[model samples]
Target: MSNERLLIIDDDVALCNLLSDYLGHEGYRVEASHSAEAALQRLADDDVWDLLILDIQMPGASGLELLQQLRPRLRTPVIMLTGRGDEIDRILGLEMGADDYLGKPCNPRELLARVRAVLRRAGPDAVVEPRLFPEQVIERSGLRLDPGLREVSVDGEALELTSAEFNVLAYLMQNAGRVMSKEQLTELVLHRKLTAYDRALDVHVSRVRQKLAPLVGDGVELIKTIRGQGYQFVKGSA
Candidate 1:
């Protein structure tokens, strides 16, 4: 049995208990909190959780608020639970640093898959494309990508990027100057298909751009939108 520890924060008591039981059976050490405040307290006391399953809507303190409070201090991978058809909550959760999201009333099987995928991506065992192993270190413009180490540095300064962002950036850089469609990127980086009206890939790309801007400088587009085509990493633009 796996020893991965997971913390689920939601206001739904029965749901929490159900998940705790179900996820426990899936070989994860699952802990549940019915309130965001209690979750925060638990996090403060012990921040060693492998992953966090957060609900977007909760009583007392919303999930977004808790996320805003947690992100700056923690780098834990988060998978948000959003209401079905609630696009805003899903987008907001992603923007707030959630690693992944699933609509509420989600299938436990799907949730387990997402959980495994996120954990695998975040873990040291994450797989990289074999093509990228030619040198294990790729440099473009002034940015250096070390696939083996899963690190990216700009002008010799390392930038902190989430696993999802790192994977997206790596794919872009690997195919610099080529337009990678949202469908392709979503499948390759997120290990999922691009659903209609899904903004997950866009949000991740936006986050990558946002994080790179401060290090790359303003007005210089490192990743450019292709106007309905997709995104291309600009080459020769430091």
Candidate 2:
């Protein structure tokens, strides 16, 4: 039995109870909070969690708000639970540093798969190729990723990249000048295949761009959108 610590934050009591029971049976030590605010207080403690299943629609301080407040400090992987067809919330949650999002009314098994995927991404070998080792720190265009430490930095200043974001950057840097399609990124980074109208990859790329812009300054396009293709990390920095 796995001993991963899991936290679920949502207002629906029945939903919470259902997931808690299901996840608990799966061998995870699970805890539930009825509101985002209450979750925030609980999260402030020293008990670090392995993953968080956060619902975007919550009373008093939405999931997005809590995510925003926790960023760069609370680096625990987050998998948001969004209402079906809630595209905006999904994208917002990604921008807020969430590792991934799933449509609500979800099945326990599917949620378990998602949880495993996110946790796998958090590991050192997030991808299949090139392999990741303790001494293997990828460096490109002033950006650095230490797989052993699971840390990324730009120009010597550390970047607070979530697991998803770090995987994106690491893969792009490893294959600079190559146009990596959304499908490829989705599969390699998120440990899932891309679906139609899946803006999750785009939103993550956008967030990476936003975080890198200020550090690298203007006119330096490290990651470029390939327009109808995908994205590429420039072979040479400006």
Candidate 3:
């Protein structure tokens, strides 16, 4: 993990120092910023971050705001640090392109676990796994997904998807028409188990649906949520 550089954006100096020390000792090159301005300036100059740990409650330009700007540009996976019960912040963070979120007062061990999971999902190994979705192109509902290239498009027009979003869409499309249970999807796509209050899967699905909406048209239902089961990718077309 020495080659993996991580940036922590939070106003809590103590927390930053704590994580910098812990993660640094864990073999990850880590950096910290106390505000969004500093983070943004640093990002503009050096956009080579492998992962970012952002606190949603920063003093100015909240983590969600900075995330909004990084999406479709940086594509660097982000794991948001949110307050306990800040479900809204967590959801907004995911919708704004966050790969994962953890509550504050977090245990460095658990944060480290999440960091590993998110990094695994965003790294090259995340896409090069051919066993999950074969190396062939999957075409369904006029949507095309090439697992080898890790590219997706609707009627040949490409769609910009985050690493997690791409994996979510790919797995769902590869098994079109089957309802993928939350537990199964989480473990398969997120590389983690589904925990209580973990809305990550649902939010990730929603983002995938949103990105596929404009290209697939208003009537195309590429992904559908099952009432009590999970989610399914319809075998229909646009």
Model 1: per-residue Cα lDDT over 1-238, one tens digit each = 7789999999888888888888899899999988899998999899999999999899889998788666424667899999889998787677556889999897888899999999988897754323422135778878998865678999999989866687788888878888989988876655556899999889989999998899988788989999989999997743
Task: Output candidate 2 Cα RMSD.
Answer: 8.1
Tell me how candidate 1 scores on lDDT: 0.83
* Candidate 2 ranges with C-alpha deviation above 4 Å: 124-238
By lDDT: ranked, best first: 1, 3, 2
Off by over 4 Å in 1: 126-238
For model 3, residues 1-238, the per-residue Cα lDDT tens digits are 4669999999999999999999999999999999988999999999999999999998879887787666534667889999999998887677556889899899999999999998887878654323444357888778888765678888889999876687788788878888889988776566556899999989989999888888877777778899989999887643
Full candidate order by TM-score, most accurate first: 3, 2, 1
Quote each prediction's TM-score.
0.55, 0.55, 0.56
Q: Supply the global lDDT for candidate 2.
A: 0.81
Would you list the C-alpha lDDT of every candidate in the order shown?
Answer: 0.83, 0.81, 0.82
Per-residue accuracy of model 2 over 189-225 as CA lDDT, tens digit each? 6545689888988888899999999998899999999
Give the candidate number with the greatest TM-score: 3
